[model samples]
Target: MSDALSEASDLSGDDSQDVMTPTELIAKLEEAWLNEKFSPELLKNKSEIVECVMEQLTHMEENLQRVRKGDVKASIHRMEIDRIRFVLSSYLRSRLQKIEKFFPHVLEKEKSRAEGDPSFLSPEEFAFAKEYMANTETYLKAVALRHMPPNLQTIDMLKAVPEPCLDSFVFLRVKERQENILVEPETDEQREYVVDLEEGSQHLMRYRTIAPLVASGAVQLI
Candidate 1:
């Protein structure tokens, strides 16, 4: 369908030469899900992938509505829908947990971001974060802040929550070959080194070094 093709194109983000097929689209979602799961910090949001997958599921469901209840095709369609639904729900749930864990930091990042920047939080997520922030403030004020000195009454959520550990090491597979990646030493006793990333090679390295590569889709976190 035209609508489905359009949605798929949006996910490509570049290389509009071809719309991503359902299989490739699902692969992209799985990549996002695993990257979010393994990364120490919340990664860039992938709402476009979510939207496109939803489109695929909806189209299939619509087709199934005309099929008989006992039809084998109907059963197959239901299984496919459920499969994609599970992945979509899990990906969203993972992001929400991270938001709750680092809400203050999430809000701070969103607020300080410049105009025209891609938001770290989707609109729905922004609302959730705001509501969570309000509730937290109310509870803290009643439970502890009211009794503290005026200067100490204010809580800095950034300081209250732990930051994502960028220095942590991650296992990644290079999707595209890259040259001259800097690998920082774990201690001062060792010297820093640079290495070329060959396409299809897997590496275990500190995340901070290849965070940009991960974002660019040059590497995938297994």
Candidate 2:
């Protein structure tokens, strides 16, 4: 586990007094989200992390209010609180982008046989997405059915339609060298030598083939 994760793991809901500060918790969550091998357990614990952050934010707000009333020492804490809020917002934005990419599917109402890998998302997250999609579909259908043209009225909802994720070809830069890549090249000329990649090299290859390397941080997606 990375240092941030290790620190996060050490914290528990019951041990409120000894738990990491809100800033540290946010940092840990951010790092975990960046990792390709994000744990389902982390998703499960998201509520607890959010609760902690909210409590801290509430306290910060109280302090800021008091400072506005004449307390000067609380000014420093206000700056730190604002910084943490910015980081927390950024962290949420990154997760939102991923959720947006999948949109209604995250809500899961219509059910797509070709659902993308949920390995990166938690069960709770998937459930919440489905709920959001269901509500949106309900609202749009009610509104659009009246406003939309005759032919377009029967249009399939984006969530109900199963669209394939086009991630087959990917561009990436090597962050670390790999002495051997198990994947084989089909051509006869490439069969004689094993695949070797050096650091700082950039290439476009099959996303599935390089997924493990990306997860391991050996390569970064471009």
Candidate 3:
């Protein structure tokens, strides 16, 4: 089956090729999901693609179970199945993390703060948001009713939520050089520094420090 999956593309001389195994299909689905996750324009209508991929995954799981019971050698594919499942789960969690970052607006409990007031989520994301809303509301109600201690009243959901900004301590390379780039200092008693970027020069800095440069295409995220 592994060999078949690798050789399946050569079976046809046309632009299209068949995926011979669940592994190959899941890999392709993961690629598409990652692409959709990064592109906001496609995210708005990504529900159909997500649903189709999920259905395919379910069918693959069912077929795998039958194969396992009928053939001893099929047990070798268990690792592959587990890996695919992990990838699928991680993909979903990554998207959910993003939705939770903007949960307030997604729940429609807050006014629009993003520019253009566009929805950066798909229908599947909206469902996840609804789940989050239900859980939060339930918790708040319990707290207000004194079912929980008053000590938990000061817990702010958003306060625990990490900033959706770039992470720290990541390396980045300059894509387009610009001089006189101003940056605010993070600590007291530190002098300000102007960025004199040069194309192709790599620098090891906190991602937050260079996030603006990345957004402006002056630097590349590595």
- Per-prediction TM-score to the true structure, in the order listed: 0.89, 0.49, 0.46
Lowest-lDDT window of 10 residues in candidate 2?
36-45
Off by over 4 Å in 3: 1-92, 98-110, 139-145, 148-156, 159-169, 216-218
Candidate 3 yields a Cα-based lDDT of 0.57
lDDT of 1 at 46: 83
Error of 3 at 29 (Å): 12
lDDT per residue for candidate 1 within 188-220, as digits (tens), equals: 999999999999999999899999998998999
Per-residue lDDT for 8-57 in model 3, tens only? 55322233333334445555556545533442211233334345456655
> Which wins on TM-score, candidate 1 or candidate 3?
1
Top candidate on TM-score is 1
Count clashes in each candidate, considering only residues at least 3 apart in sequence or on different chains: 0, 4, 0
> Per-model C-alpha lDDT, please?
0.87, 0.58, 0.57
